[model samples]
Target: MTIIGWMIVFCEIAFWVVIVLGLMTRYIFKKKQLGIILLALTPLVDLTLLIAAGIDIYRGEVATTAHAIAAVYIGISIAYGKSMIEWADQRFQYYVTKQGEKPRKRYGIEYSKHYFKGWIRHFIAYIIGGGILVGLIFWIDDISRTQALSGVAKIWSIVLGIDLIISITYFIWPPKEKGISSGT
Candidate 1:
């Protein structure tokens, strides 16, 4: 793997470690302020990856799949980080601290709405990440250097389209709730 690939892996690991530490501090140790501080630092990991990728490109290195993926990772982190943190916090609160109710499971129309909302988040991530790839392609100003990023963008675009189709199907055929009858 390239340096960018290693950096991406490190960033992912750092993000989760920071999240767990933040949650542990908040719930396990009862240090709310410190926990918030640690949680807020999650973005730093993304920033570090972004800077590393930028520096690599600035050094005249050709952009690789790893570099494109770094953009996607940063975009996803920015778009979903808060919700992910909330998700983890809810689980920690319910299972570890025992202070809140268990997270509720959605069904029927509610599940469809949830799925749709997730698709919207994915769209946002695509825009942000794709925007970065385009910007990098222009900045590099060489087709040979940016082919990997363009390929990633094309693949991601297809994935987004497929996701939209699946999400819409959730609305067309909403999931049935357990133990509920359709009045047949």
Candidate 2:
């Protein structure tokens, strides 16, 4: 892997590690702001990695394994960032403030609405992020460099397909009860 690719790999690993550890510290260690700060900074790592990758491609380096992994990491993050953060936040709230109370969302329009919003966000992210990847592919090609754009595209298509399936399933299986109005 190129230096850029290795950087991406390192960044991706660091991103998840930070988030997980941050959550543990925030909830388990009772350090809320510090943990949240660490979790929130994970995206900056992604941004730096992306800048490095972009610079590499701009300088005519062919994409490598690291690039491919980074592409998937970016795609997944774009699609799931909000939902994942919300999930973590809910868990944190339950443990930290709710005092062991189980978090619940009543099945209602609001329930469906929140998920539908998430679906739209994920779909839009796939489009924008996928376009960026494709643009990078073309850019690399235009400069006479051979990158694994096709392979990356294939992987993206699978991600899109999976997201679509998930959204559809969520829509079809709406909850039947009324959701509670907890100040989120």
Candidate 3:
């Protein structure tokens, strides 16, 4: 095998090691990191196939052993990132409340006078974060250099906008208070 193939294998191995370490210890490095690492090392793996198997993964010509390994890395990474994000979010809520002053409790629409402050602002803020991530993908990758970006673009446009909005709104604005008064 060429150095590129070896590099792919090395990266794959590193991904697993990080995941195991996270699970056993901190558990922060998962899904996105996994995907990022896989994508980061994809060139190496693709190059190996180009050199050894005479196929180009970037051009979508062939699926080699490295391709399978890359797929696994993405799948596992997505799972890991999601798990980590959720874990971190829960802990973050606690940490913020514990260490910092709590924002005034969300009472009702009456108390929240600003337009969008209660509901819409929460959604917009979320989409903003997602939009930022999508923008990152566009800036970091060779969009024209690789065919894979089309898929990335398609997925991000939809999920990034909606999921980000939902996730952020849930965390930031919080659920409606059931029994509290806005104080008339």
**How well is each residue in 1-184 modelled by candidate 2, as lDDT tens digits?**
5787678668868877887788778877899899888888877877887788787777767776566566656766767776777676677668655655577765746666777677677667667566767777776665335356656667767876786676567667666654534445
Which of 1 and 3 is ahead in lDDT?
Answer: 1
lDDT score for candidate 3 against the true structure: 0.43
lDDT of 1: 0.96
RMSD of each: 1.0, 6.2, 12.1
Off by over 4 Å in 2: 1-9, 92-100, 103-118, 143-147, 158-162, 169-184
Residues 84-181 of candidate 1 have per-residue lDDT tens digits of 99999999999988889899989889999999999999999999999999999999999999999999999999999999999999999888889988
Worst 10 residues of 2 by lDDT: 141-150
- Ranking of models by lDDT: 1, 2, 3
Alpha carbon lDDT at 14, candidate 3: 58
Against the true structure, whose TM-score is highest? 1
Instruction: After the best TM-score superposition of candidate 1, give how far the Cα of residue 128 lies from its true spot, in angstroms.
Output: 0.8
TM-scores of the models, in the order given? 0.97, 0.65, 0.28
* Model 3 Cα lDDT, one tens digit per residue, 1-184: 5443565566656544543443323323445455444434433533443343223443433333443333333333433444443444445445642432443454444343432332343344334433433443354455443333345435545754575566555555545688756456
TM-score of 2: 0.65
